[model samples]
Target: MKLKKLMTILLTTVITTAVLTGCGQQENAKDAQKKPLKVATNATFVPFEFKGDGDSDYKGYEVDMIRAVGRVMGRDIEFNNIPFSGIIPIIQSGDMDVAASGMTITKERAGKVLFAAPFYESKLVILTNKNSGIKSVEDLKNHSVAVQMGTTAADYAQNLGLKTKQFDHNAEALMELKIGGSDAVIADKPVADYYVATEGKGEDVVIPIPDSKKEYLAFAMNAKNKDLQKEINAAIAKLKETGEFQQIYKKWFNVDPGDLPKTAEETLQ
Candidate 1:
């Protein structure tokens, strides 16, 4: 009778243990499936990422492209709005999984983060009020130029020994130009063009510098996330081949993406 009782107790204990283990495994699987891909972006740049008027949601070319990438990787994407200067550090700290805010790939940036394939080619342009008479890079000499802080445009302006007014956003820099606080605003060509069109700055001019080098924009992540980088690279290649990339480009820029390099490394060559 004692043996029968002992057997029954052992059976019940074994069944309970097995059920608990199964439940734990199922919960772990669900947690893995629910993990989101956190993407960090600065939403001040239009055509790249920005908040629309009267809208709480962020939208732009980069936002759309990253969403497509998330779909390709079978992950839910969550965007976190962060300052441009802090985006890299946040990714390095593992607080964010990706940074895709029209970030231009540079040697300094490459050392800190792993960049995916190039998604867009851009150039700096000088934007000035029509009557400002700033027609070229040389004209910026002795003029108070406005640029977004931590951007290549600001670096270029400082390198040229020009007096510069730094703003957190490109829109503020352009507004400084309009208000006569700055003689000119130097920024990405697409951003300048977008501002001019939307702000009713019909008199503004976009002056492309002849010697300015092209900047290749790409998504960046922590160096340790090589697997994620590879997946993103594959997604970008697939998007390009499937015509989805060109469609997004046309939707944002109103023109075909003509002969742009397939990867950031390709631009180096």
Candidate 2:
């Protein structure tokens, strides 16, 4: 009888262990699926995503917007500061899940990654010293222009047959313009305007690029992240509906939020 009772107890203990092990495995799977998203940004673009003063985290339009999206999705955002050039490649490799680098949506980039809703309206412009006399895109023909590598501005300059100097960051490219290493700096309209309004005041001038088409900027992710793209787009739409999107826009830009493009395609009806 003693032997039989001992055998029964051992069998019960084995069964209980197996059941608990299965439950633990299932819980681990759930936890893995809920892992925080890794967001990559080059914290060099002011009013977009730049490091704040005194041990503060990144503060800018993109940073705020990403945080808002994470809140609406009930997901946590894990920020990784990286160079703007590597933003896309890392997304493709699954090293990062989102790009918050204030990236302009281009047809070529659209082919490589999925874009969320367009957030900011932008265009290219020329930034130069007031004494440089570069008032138009045509004026850049014979001048050495500085541009941030991996940006549409660089491609635009190259395509326009201008002598171009590429820098890893737009700030450096702008500095090159200030130091006379380049005759002019070509950058996104908003960034140039920000510099002109703040640090570049009195000494710098922004020339509207003639025939420059309107550009849209947005968040991008791996092409395979369609579900996440939908969630983000939905979150942005909600933010717009709640008027939070415009609030954020006004906070950084001090301007009314205009209607955002529904898609990146320039010809959208």
Candidate 3:
């Protein structure tokens, strides 16, 4: 009977240990799955990401889009404001997990980072005051142009030999044109249109730059994080497939986005 009692005590001890071990593993899995992601975005672009109309926190298309991506990623995201020029570097340094600042994905940039599927289709255009006497792209010559620093628009303006005035944000560049500090502002078509619609008060005009090519915008991650990039790509795909993305697109663009890139490679457009 003494031997039997000792055996029974040992069996109970082993069983309890097993149960506790299983519970600890389960808790660890939950903790691992609940880790939050950090995102970098420049919020000075209208209709994309911007300081709220009064809310302070971000309130724009990319803000809603990134949050949706986070939901599909099964992680909460903390959006941080980095300068547009610093976003890529921050991602490269692994300090940021994502970049979604109306960033245009190009071969040069894609070579440095892992790009998810494109979320927005865009083009560059010229923005000027309505009475600035600039009716066409050709008329922009010999005039100073304001541009958001480090943007394709600035590159385009410089390549064309225009006097370039670079600012850190689109709002500031547009303001330069508004106050007659610059002859015009070259920016993304949608951004120029958004400003004209919301605050231009019939004083601004958007003109297409002839021969401008289409540009695609996507969330970028550090090249080392392929798994995270896959997760982000899946999030974008799922959002588009379920029609949730369209609702958000229409909210800002006033029209359907139709479709976005289906895969990472397709985003190269």
Candidate 4:
């Protein structure tokens, strides 16, 4: 009777161990499947996803690129539109998976987040009123230049020895410029061009900066997310090769896409 009882207890212990191990494995699998990536961005910037012309839907360049990336990766990209300054902090705190707000892959930003290769390039332009007589950066030396806060354009404007009036968004700064509250505005070329072409107030603006101040934009992910960055790089390579990237560029900028390096193209190879 003692031997039989001992045997039954041993058998039960073995079964319990196996059951616990199996449950752990199943739970791990489920966790892996549920890890959908969240991409953070500042959607207020136009031609790169913003609240549409009074509509609720998002529109513009980054919107199309994010959706294309989702399709290529077989995953959904959830865009969290936060303040520009909040993007890096949120990513650092593990609140977001990636950021793609036409972000310039600068050395400072690169140190904070893993940046993918350059996917888009935009010129840095200065905008001044038609009657301001500010035709160049030099013209704004002592004048107050309005720029979007916490942006590279703002940094550049400061570096040029201009007095800066920083606003949270480019639209606000541009508005100030139009109302004669600022001497000039510094921003990306596409945005300046868009405003000049569409907004009545922007009609008086002139692009004072040349093409040499162009900036390259890339996607950013947490430093720990090497795998996600690799996947994104692969997707960029695929899009570049299949000509889809060029099409999107044309759609947004009305220009053919620039050339990518052989290494960037061969990343997935």
Candidate number with greatest TM-score: 3
How far out, in Å, is residue 114 in model 2? Answer: 0.4
Q: Give the winner by TM-score: 3 or 4.
A: 3
Question: Runs in model 3 with CA error above 4 Å?
Answer: 1-32
Clashes of each: 0, 0, 0, 0
Q: Could you tell me how far off, in angstroms, the CA of residue 195 lies in candidate 2 after the best superposition? A: 0.2
Candidates in order, TM-scores: namely 0.87, 0.87, 0.88, 0.84
lDDT of 1 by residue, 21-133 (tens): 99999999778656788999988888799898898888999999999988887888898987787888898998899998888988888888898988888999998888887
lDDT of each: 0.87, 0.87, 0.87, 0.77
The local distance difference test score of model 3 is 0.87
User: In candidate 2, how many Å is residue 196 off?
Assistant: 0.5
Candidate 2, RMSD to the unseen true structure: 3.8
Residue 57 in candidate 1 has what lDDT?
89
Native-to-model Cα distance after best TM-score fit, residue 222 in candidate 1, in Å: 0.5
**Which sections of candidate 4 miss by over 4 Å?**
1-35, 200-202, 208-212, 261-269
Q: What does candidate 3's lDDT look like per residue over 24-86, in tens digits? A: 999997896578778899989998999965777888898899999999878897989878989
* Residue 267 accuracy (lDDT) in model 4: 25
Report the C-alpha lDDT of model 4 over 72-174, residue by residue, as the tens digit: 8777777787878788888888788878777776668767888776777677888777778777777788788898888898889778677999987667888
